[model samples]
Target: MKSWRDSVRNVVPYTPGEQPKEDGVIKLNTNENPYPPSPKVLEAMKEITNLRKYPDPAVSDLTEALSSYYRIDSSEVFVGVGSDDVLAIAFLTFFNSDVPVFFPDITYSFYDVWADLFQIPFERKPLNEKFEICAQDYYGENGGVIFPNPNAPTGALLELETVRDILDHNREVLVIVDEAYIDFGGESALSLIHDYDNLLVVQTYSKSRSLAGLRIGYAMGNRELIKAMSDVKYSFNSYTMNEPSIVMGTAAIKDEEYFQDTRNKIIKTREWFQEELRELGFSFADSKANFVFAAHESIPARELFEAAKKEKIYVRYFDKPRINNYLRISIGTDEEMQALVRFFKSMMNK
Candidate 1:
């Protein structure tokens, strides 16, 4: 008789950025917004009084809020626990073909994990030398395509024309644009939703709206695609979102002024930080996201990563190939960035 353990499924998990428990550390490992959620979100959370009842399984209120904010119909929006949850469901719903799905080799690491977990075949199309996605590479045959705009770690933004070029080629299969950081400085693929039925644009409040703690994420696409994902979600979990999250997420979407203010602050800080890094002999692509992927001319990234941690400053360092020498640093507040720059200056002086 075979043991129960032998029947268990096992796969490598996606390792997330470290969350240090201690206080007084400048945490920037995960690409989380350093600011608090909108005032409206806090106010709305105060109204979530009924803890006894189940939150709406459909997540209608939050869904409607996103729809209004994006100017799409509610039927074209699907809400989830986070973009991670939403993208996982998308991978499961689509990518059913025998051919391997395609995405950037250096994109959000979770894409490969989700594909592996779902037992789906996938191929990683390598980004160019500059860490930019090559549109022609994705023109070939595959199961489906998904990549982030202003992609992760590298923080390089693909223009809308390039996005359309890829979509134009792969109209037969679903193309998912993971826009988790679109609000930073990238033009969104949301405008192409009506032009291409196969397109699904996923965005989250975590980065731009400071709601990572609430785990609010959503996808906007054609009504048909939205229905398919919603159907799969309901089949899997009826109430993926709780009452507080639903109310708070709705409030976050409604506060457009606060959202814009915070997003601009992050972008400004990111630009300033990049200039500082360059002055310190660092090289990186011009980033449009909230973070910068940089490599020093002489110092190894691991050394800098350790040195920064010792000073109570945290940033993301990927030990993967190609990017092994690079560090992805998130943009914090003005004072936080100044301190980071000062730390770098001290390291150089040594």
Candidate 2:
């Protein structure tokens, strides 16, 4: 419609993984934590008595809590509704120049959407045949750079040295390392943020802390970069985090014991499932995230997706080139994963 702004009208939005609400459907499409949040978080959420006032524009409590947990200065932290919001604001705040930003051809699908929506030039540097990012490919000139550590869907991780190499090459332009799944089993680039002025490392509590429902994500970077992001956030929306989310997020970060227990459980389950897939003749990358991207030796990924859906099981299937044959299966509870293994065994043997 001509009534709409030209930017909104021409944009092709990012498609997230499906969220099926029906009972009995084992939801594993979105990489959400299958475990419940800490009891302390639930208790804190129940204490949201003040609904009359707006949340803190600065998101003070959660920011302070995250700062303490990560042992970083509060000025170096920025919080938003989710990593999506943080990343979106980042795209707007930075990536303004005409020079093309660079990322993996098979990385988080949202990167391209953000670039297109904002009219920022970008190039998708192809990953090697092994689905691993080549740090050298990101070496040349660019406006900005961003990629997921343990890159999504494939879950292939670039070592810390490789990450440092890319940062070394792109010192002038902004570099964002989206560590959305880093809690699963990968070294975070957060340690490099202190050294690289251009580095901004983003993470979410949705996975490890089991706070997806709270919708809180944060970034750690140099004080200057965080100030720019904060300015953009305030200009767009003064109050992003809700009272309940802030309180609950603060409580979740404090429950270190529960967080470690749940994360360890998921990692153990992922390792066990990886062995099961190997025995089933499936080929996959060594995923460090809480998901497994694997392809069956005989059965097509598309067919497996459909068959699993019929069984009331939902797994992520990307209908894109180079990765269409693979299934991105999020690690569910031990019992849920075992059920999936049994189902795969039956279907593959048949």
Name the candidate that leads on TM-score. Answer: 1
In order, the Cα lDDT scores of the candidates are: 0.92, 0.93
lDDT by residue for model 1 (171-208), tens: 89999999999999999999999999999999997888
Q: Write the per-residue lDDT of candidate 2 for residues 117-169, one digit (tens) a residue.
A: 88999999999999999999999989999999989978988899999999999
TM-score of 1: 0.99
Residue 241 in model 1: lDDT: 96
Candidate 1 regions off by >4 Å?
none
RMSD of each: 0.9, 1.4
Supply candidate 1's per-residue lDDT for 114.
Answer: 94
Clashing pairs in 1: none
- How do the predictions measure up, each by TM-score? 0.99, 0.98
* Candidate 2, position 330, lDDT: 94
